[model samples]
Target chain A: MLLIPCPYCGLRDESEFVYGGPARALPDMDAQTPEAQHSLYRPINPRGPLRELWYHSGGCECWITLTRNTITHEFEDDLS
Target chain B: MGYSALSLMGHAFRGNTQWPTLIAAPDMRTIYDIVIIGGGGHGLATAHYLAKIYGLTNIAVCEAGWIGGGNTARNTTIVRSDYLLNGSFALKHFALKLWEDLTQDLDFNIMYEPRGYIDLAHSDGELEQFELRANAMRLRGADAQILDRSALKARIPLLSLDMDKRFPVSGALFQPAGGVVRHDAVAWGFARKASQAGIHIFQNCPVTGFDISDGVLQGVQTAKGHITCKQALISVAGESSAVAGLAGINLPLNSINVQACVTEPVKPALDAVVNYNVGLSYLSQTAKGEFVLGGATDGYASFARRGSFERIEDVLARAVQMFPFLSRLRLMRHWSGTADITADGNAIVGQTPVSGLMINSGWGYAGFKATPAVGHQLAELLATGILPDLIAPFALDRFALGAEQDDAGIGPYPWLH
Candidate 1:
């Protein structure tokens, strides 16, 4: 059980949150080009630490960003 | 030695001391006709077919660890061909047909138990959807039927019909030919056969980099030494993105962890594999009397092969709800595997952006069942350089062409798959 640190509501259980994938800027929703598909679908997923998004659905219901290790499951609540 | 009644008697007389090893770990060669990365079930099976069917002998299977150490040894070992999509159903059913002869073909027992599979539907709409899927599966020569409440009860006597008050049992999709196989035996069988065919099966040989020049793959750089090959197949399941990245190619893949567990051995009570489709939980009793259980993925991308406690709790809770007796059994083991999931919930096979390099990956949670067909088709593709119709729809560029094979209608979300 991951105690994800939600910025709005402090640390919460993983069941209280939904995992949004790798953190990236939103792409053009209307663009249908291959580049757009690559942007939306193909994410740069490293096996090491990286920034990701998590929705605090059961808590504050707010999206929070955090830098976490994919392999180790360690996290830092530095980012808001 | 070819295993037979004569060999068995001879071995028994010799106290089984003269039985040779299953496979050999040979020294890596400098060059080969083909190199298959990841000596899991898929890679070894491909090597076996490549040598036996295509008659290509100059091959080597490079494994990061020992054979069958990866997802090949981690899956729940459910084999079925009741997919809703035409292409997916065709590939799996073809694999199912191949599975029927796999024990004989590989000259080893894979423990292919066709003990039937049942998918429970909780609502009228889901039953209709299962009917559509049943028709699709039957069209592809797979035996599928829709069973109602009484039929499901009769098929699984231990199944509680109204256990979950929120979602009542409406019907189920039954596949008479679907069951489980011995997971480790699959990799071992392929490794033994491929090794006998003179394919080098190298253990602890991790491919560190790719030898590509001008968008053409020359070979691979391993921890032992650089091995040159004419053609290469990247069959690394969850590491598809990482390995392809070595060739400067980016694949639309995310490695997510999926988990399964088994209970302590008990008397054999369950006869068929039962899946509570509405709850997304499944279980099957092994010949050893252990109840193998599993549920959804962890719903995140991670390389950690450890599953979350939340998922374990949820799956067991659902399992106990369906079979009340399971609540009494204690869990014996639990583990997870990194699954290569694609956006559309379909596999990505065939050529990538890099020439002379192909991939057989993006099999999120269902690669174990498709081992034989993937081996056969990918061997054909590597030998002939032609995309077989069975896997052409799963090309890497399908997402761009609006040809996504989202069989579950879950849209383009890897986690949802």
Candidate 2:
């Protein structure tokens, strides 16, 4: 399980985590082309650093981006 | 490490080799070519491998409860091979490779996503320690990279890399081959395939005793009937020592109960599973959006599988610190399982004193991740009636020498053994 760093909660158990997939700076509402929205909604599952949303249900109950390695399940960053 | 080596251990690897000499004819009818004592994932996978790969058809999987309901399904569902030790190098990576190809191998959708996993360094001291881990992986041919504060932010823009922040993300050690899998699916998939391979699965049948009269295993005494088998494979996880007790041998094992919980479902949230190696806790969002969390196992081990509020409280404080988005989600269900913790955290594989009995036991926490390796190696043991080289070190005598296989040590935690 990934010990995600919640900005408000700190490092918590992965069970306390709620996976908020694909956190975007902005929702893709202003796409000029259909392909842009399609690409926005459907990202690839490649290996690398991924931006993830994790909730600290076991602690203060705040949401944050959990920079994670999909392969390692290790929390890279605790996005506040 | 196959059956031939059993002679050296004085039959500690295979319990009942000469079935005809030990069991009576009446009780022998229930016997199978291979009788697996635990219906957990390892047992089921072993059965599947023997039946599918080795064509060892006549096998029966006996479980104390519904199959796959043991420690096999009680984990946080995380899998990885990033370790800083040499002994753990082969075993952890073997499972990692198997996890990567599991979906195709099992012919079932395990939802295995090998995105990656990261380790946070909160202090310069911690960063120095992570460098050792990164170096270990490099020596073992595993990919691991150290990320600085700026590089960490570029990789993950939202991280609070500032040193001034509380619990700042000073740096990280990331490995892009670790991931998650549907724990139950691995069990079900193996069971389904094993059963189809002419292996009979008996549920709610607890093995009470081994019908051993004169230093030989005749068969097993269960609630239903006495099963006489030529070979027996025992994969009982939490109750491994309990099963061994039937043969009048006290195994050096501890049954530690671990508890975990899941939250009510919500919209899809987290993309990858995250963990804190120092805190000894982790949380990940399921595909259905429920938050699954677990921290330290119940402090001061007991046989009780039930959990306490203290452990939960510890996990919650850390959870909130990591991600503040969980205050809204309601805690739904919590469950527990007795995990068979060995003197060493590694598994104990090979034959036992009694003939015809082989064991796949003592996986402290990584049982779910090692399902494939256990199955594959166990099958080889069962077919040739011998122990495999891969699992040879995880034998019964390691306990006597005070050798513990405690890997999973990510940071510079104190040496447990």
- Cα lDDT listed for each candidate: 0.89, 0.69
Chain A TM-score for candidate 1 is 0.83
- Which lDDT value does model 1 have at B380? 94
Name the DockQ score for candidate 2.
Answer: 0.01
Model no. 1, DockQ: 0.77
lDDT of 1 by residue, B218-271 (tens): 989998899998799999998988988888888888889899999999998998
lDDT of 2 by residue, B261-313 (tens): 88899776665566655565577778888878877665323345665565676
Tell me each candidate's TM-score: 0.97, 0.73
Q: Which candidate ranks first by DockQ, i.e. highest?
A: 1
Model 2 reproduces what portion of true contacts? Answer: 0.00
DockQ list for all candidates: 0.77, 0.01
Clash pairs, candidate 1, are: none
The candidate 1 chain B region of ten consecutive residues with least summed lDDT is: B162-171
True contacts kept of each: 0.73, 0.00
